[model samples]
Structure formats: C-alpha cells, structure tokens
Target: MAEVEEIKNLETNKCKQNKRKPWDDGPCLDRWEIEKFDPSWNPSGMLEVGSFSRAYPKRREKHLLKCWPRVKSALEEHGVSCELNVVGRYMSVSKTKMTRDPDIIVKARDLLRLLARSVPARQALKILEDDMAYDIINIRRMVVGSKEDFLIRKIRFLGHNSSSLKALETSTNCFIRMQGNTVAAMGSFRGLKRLRIIVGTCFRHDIKCVLWMS
Candidate 1:
C-alpha cells in the first residue's frame, strides 16, 4: 500500500510538471518584437504613410486655362478635382480632402509644372504618351533649362521660319534661333556637337558658325 501510494504521488508530480502555463500557451511575444532579434527580418516595401498631397503655388490663370483641356483629362482619369482663381492665379489640386486616392497626384503635378513652363498643351500632353519618354523629358528639362528658355527660342524660330532652320531642328535636335545676326543653337550637348559638324561640313557659308551657350 505504501509503495502504491508513492507511485501515485510520483505520477501526480509528473503530470504537474507537464502542465502548460497560460502565458506559455499564448504567443510569447509579437512578431515585430521577435523581428528585432532576427538578423534577416525586413518590413514590407509597400507601406503607405499618409496622404501624398501638398500645397502647390497658384500660377497664371490664363496659362491654366490654356492647358485646361489636358489638365482636366489627366485629373479626371484619377477622379481628382482642381479649383482655380483666375484673378489671383491661385489654383489648388487635392485628392484626400475629398476621400479619393492620391496616388496619381504626382503625375498631375508634373503635367501642371510642364504647363507652367509655358509648354504648349500639345507638347505638355505628350508626357502621357510613354512613361520612359516622360522620364527622359523630365531629366532633359532639368539639365537644359526652364520651359521659359525653350519658349524664347521657339518665338525666335517662328520669326525666321525658314525651311533650313526647321530641318536643323529636326535633324540635329538643336533649335536654331537668331540672337541678333548670329545663329544660336540651343539643345542637348549631343545635339550641339551634331550641329557643329553639320555647320562645318555643309552650311558654313550660310550660317557662318554655330554658337552654343555653355
């Protein structure tokens, strides 16, 4: 009887040792807490922080109206709304305020900036044609100059409007314009080199020499 009692006591002890605690049965710690100890753990790449909208400076009302068609079309696709103050040039574009997704606002801003540069609605809208080309245009615009500079060159070109100058713009990517009597070539560095070669080879007599602004 004593031996049997001892055996029963031992079995009870083993069962008590095997019992699980409430805390142990549950998740001991959060996954993020465990991640701190893990060398290979990483957060997800697609985390959204907040609304991606901001206050943009109001531009010329006439300018906005000129590019209104392209602007309206681009923003309408994303369901974004824009308000304009023609007298003050105070235009505001927002998305989250109206409970709409703000993902496409960045592209809209790009188009707006392009228009603000005095780029024609036709050329500004071309940004929507190809994503790759749009990226290139952004880089080129940054490096070359502002849209204002390009507009100045364009105005000069129309005054001359010669077939040969148009061909130069087409062939060499250099938009040749008259700066007084001399021909000024404005374009990317590559276009400038090609223009120089063309001037040296074929049109030295007519153009004298091509000058580029550094």
Candidate 2:
C-alpha cells in the first residue's frame, strides 16, 4: 500500500512538471495589442512639419494649383499631409498618424523644394525614391566677378545652344537646371558629386577647357 501511494505521488509530480504554463504559449497578440502593452513599440504621436518658401510661387501659381491635387495624392500614399499656402508663397508637409517611416517627412520636404525650384512634378516625384536626391547649389556665391562677368560665365555654362549643359547632364547622369543665381540638380550620389565638380569648374575655368578634360 505504501509503495502504491509513493508511485501515485511520483506520477502526480510528473504530471505537474509536464503541464505547460500560460506564458509558455507566449503572447498571442495582434499588432495593436502588442503595441498597447509595450509603449516603446509604438511610433511617436508628435507631429513633424517641414516648411519651404518657393522662389517663384507667383509665376508658377497656376501650374502649382493644377498639380497640387496630384502631389497631395502622392504624399497621402506615403502617410504624409501637405498644404500649400499660395498667399504666403510656401508649402508645408506634416506627419500624420499613419506615418511610420521617419525618413518620409524629409523626402516629402525635398519633393516640395524641387517643385518650388521649377522641377516638373513628374521629375520632382523622383525625390520620394530611396536612391534619388536633389541639391540646390548657390552659384551666386561662387562667382568672383562683376555682373557682366557673371552673365558671361552663365552663358558659357549653357554653351552654344546648351550643348555644354547637355553634355554635362549626359556624362554625370543628372538633370541640371539653372534658375536665376542657383543651380538645381537631381541624381544619385555619384552623379551629384560629378555635377557639383563640373558646375564649380564652369565658374572657375572656361567651359571648353572643362569639357576637354572631361
């Protein structure tokens, strides 16, 4: 009887040891449910805004109005909210609840800046891509000459029938635009680097000489 009682107790112990704990199954949680339990798991609710002042808002007002709908829709697809202040001549981008990627706001800002710089909406949208980037180089500061000299240098940069500019674009694989005193370019990092060097050379040396070296 004693032996039987001991065997029964041992069997009970084995049963208890083999039983699974509630935690052993892990938390069967949906995404939101998991976020609810872990505060760090959720993205911040704070709003982020990026604002830009366009250089020629009045001149492009009509075109901007026409393209605003498309731009807004594109931004919406990325969980960004955009607003155009026509009177203020500025555009603003803000993060919304749906925004999860932190880099999206920066990309949205670049898109607006490119549009403001007179880049076509179709081309400007390229900024939203991960591998694309844009830069606005202030050529006004690079010129060390009088207004006439500056004009002459600008003309040289454009070349006869813009052939020089076209060649630079082809060689560097970048799109370049001369807007007033600034030069805006969009391309990959390597392309942009070559563009900056070539543009700086245009201001420093004769375009013909730069072309020969290239």
Candidate 3:
C-alpha cells in the first residue's frame, strides 16, 4: 500500500510538470525549439521591418526638433514652410511664413494637439487636406444649439464593418472619430456640406437641420 501511494504521488507530480512546461509561468524559457526561418514558408510572409528615420529632406525655414512623418507631410503638402531641428531636449520649430497669422497658428496648434493625443497622425492630418476654404470649429465652440442638432444617432458601420468609416471619409473628405454613441467629424466647407446631406438622407430623424454661420 505504501509503494502504491508513492507511485501515485510521482505520477501526479509528473502530470503537473507536463502541464506547467508549456505555460509561461516563469521569466525565462526552460526549453526552446529554434528552426531555420524561411520567409517563403512563413505564415505572414517576409514582413517589412519598420524604421524611425525620416525619408524626406529636412531643409526648410521652420524647424521642429521632431515631428511625426504624417504631420511633416501635411505641412509640406499645404505649402506651410517648416523644418525640424533638434534642440537640447525638445524639438524647436521655426516657421518663415504665416508665423504671425492667428488663424494659421491656431490650425498648427490644433494639428499638433491631435497628433500628440490618442488620434492617429494620418487621420489627424486630414483636416489640412481641403478642396474648399473652410473655418475650423470645435464642438465646444458651439455653446448654443438645438438638442436635435447636437445629438447624432450613429448607424454602426453602416452596412459593412469599420471600412464604412473610411468610405465616409473618402466620400465626404472628413476626419471622423467615433465617440461612445455618436461620431465627431472634422472637415472643410465642402466636406461638411456633403456630410450634412448624408446625415439628412441617411440618418433622417436624427438631424432636423444643418446650418453654419461665420
């Protein structure tokens, strides 16, 4: 009986060891199988490695010690003269043109804010790409508005999944962020015009009217 009990205990311990071997309960690997990596046979297939270096030339009047690639691209595309320069511990910005203009300065600050926050840099820069001249307005700026006007009923992904959001962006030329139950959109005059039409037709009862006044 004693011998049988000892054998049972050994078997239980062996089973526990087998179960724990595969689990990552420890910091280091006890055993590893290193096979020769073949890109062709890889499930993901030779993925491209990412780099932190800037591909564009850093020669411009404006200097920002560091800026995201998307931010720099948007600035260059919009004819905003700027460059990046590394200061002691911060990025120093130098702008040759439109430095004194309040509107341009405001837009620049907004752009930086969006990029620095949780928003993706590419999505944030969409505000800079506009076919029509439009004033940028924040939702907080409008203190007075109808409840119907402020409230938006979001039709989740329209028909498809998240690509619908991208479709809306392409169609309306807007940068849209989905909040808890509604969507926050940023666009130019023309883009907003299209978006308003979309809301009226698609959303129907949610929006009574769309109006913008300078």
Candidate 4:
C-alpha cells in the first residue's frame, strides 16, 4: 500500500504527457536518476488501458481470453511467483449460472474496481475489509516483501468514489481516474493504477471535491 502511494508521487502526477503511458511503455528506472535501467527489471506492466475499462481493454466477457495468460506469463518470465487467483465471482451451487471474473486479481483492491458505479464505499468497505482478510489469507504464503511493498502503476479508476485514497492531491502516477459519480471519466490524472470493472452499478456517479482519504 505504501509502495502504491510512492508510485503515485512519481510519474503519474508529473504532468509530462507523451504518446504512450509511462507504465505501459516506460522504463522502470527513473529517467532523471539513471541513464540505464536494470535490464532485469521486468515487472508486468499494470494495464489500465482506458478510462472506462480497467486492465480490461474491452468487455469483461472475453477477459479470460485476452488479459490473463499474457500477464501470468510475463510475471513468471520475470520470476514473480504468486498464486493466480480470480476473486470476483459469487457462485450458485443450487443451479448453474454465469460466472463472471475480472481479468486479473491481486488482493482486496479489486472490490472498488469491480464495483463500477454500483455501491458506495461506506456501504462497501465492510465487504472490502472482509475481502482484505481473504486477501491476506490467500497471500500468506508470499515469500517476498510485504504486500505493501508491491508497486502498482498505469491503472485506471472509473468511478467518482474517492473514499480513503489520496487520488485528488496529485501525487500518484498514471491514475486515469473518472471524476465524480459519473460513469464517464471526468479527465485523466496520475494515481496508482488499480481500477477494476464489474457487471452491475456499484459506485457513486461523479467525482467529489477534495477527498477525505488524506
């Protein structure tokens, strides 16, 4: 979580726009500090491609077909090993039903992202807290740095619900947030990339002024 905050302060809020996003196409090393980046620094690029769909470039129906395998392979190639878990589904054992899962899931962050414009944070944090518990349980076997150390970049946040995040302060990187409660994005700015997409309306409609997260 702290690492995510640190990245938000780096490139996302720099206001230095280019043809490609810093995350999707930029080097991991800082441009000013290092002349050459470590060639081995090959973390999977956080794919927050557009304002509407996070990581999901298109509709979620083809999520399995499009995003998962490439990301999984890329992480493995760089030797980042963690269980690949899909955490967004609610199953029905009583009868067969459609199973909708986001493209990729890291931890509890998916709750807000998967919500789209559905629920409010005040209403949803409970579930998110539980999911966080589940997240820690699932990743208890992680052998590397703590969960707060992992970096997230170039992700999208589609809704206006900025409950606890410091997104409004302009410190984060490549955030691409949709302002206010409106489903459509207000504009793009930089923050840690962790936006998600789900089926129903689950968040506020427009971006509010001056977040309380700080």
User: Who wins the TM-score comparison?
Assistant: 2
TM-score of decoy 3: 0.36
lDDT of 4 by residue, 1-214 (tens): 4543454454344565634564665656443331323323434443332112223222332443334455334334322322322354321111011111122223123433433333233332232221121111111122135433211100122223443223432433222223232221111111222221110101211111222133
Residue 144 local lDDT, model 2: 87
Look at candidate 3 and tell me the lDDT of residue 104: 38
Backbone clashes in model 2, listed as residue pairs:
none
> Compared with the true structure, what per-residue lDDT tens digits does model 2 show for residues 69-184?
99999988877888888777778888888776667788898888888888888888888876787889998787887888888888888888998888888888898888999999
Best by lDDT: 2
List per-prediction Cα lDDT, in the order shown: 0.45, 0.74, 0.43, 0.28
* Per-residue alpha-carbon lDDT of candidate 3 for residues 34-64, written as tens digits (9 for 90 to 100): 2332324433422232112222223321323
For model 2, state the Cα shift of residue 72 in Å.
0.7
Between which residue pairs do clashes occur in model 3? Answer: 62-83, 62-94, 63-83, 63-93, 63-94, 64-84, 65-85, 65-91, 65-92
Prediction 4 TM-score vs. true:
0.22
Runs of candidate 2 exceeding 4 Å displacement: 1-56, 209-213
Question: Which model is ahead, 2 or 3, in terms of TM-score?
Answer: 2
Sort by TM-score, best first: what order? 2, 1, 3, 4
Return the clash pairs for model 1, or none.
none
lDDT measured at residue 118 in model 1 versus the true structure, 0 to 100: 49
Ranking of models by lDDT: 2, 1, 3, 4
State residue 101's C-alpha deviation in candidate 4, in Å.
28
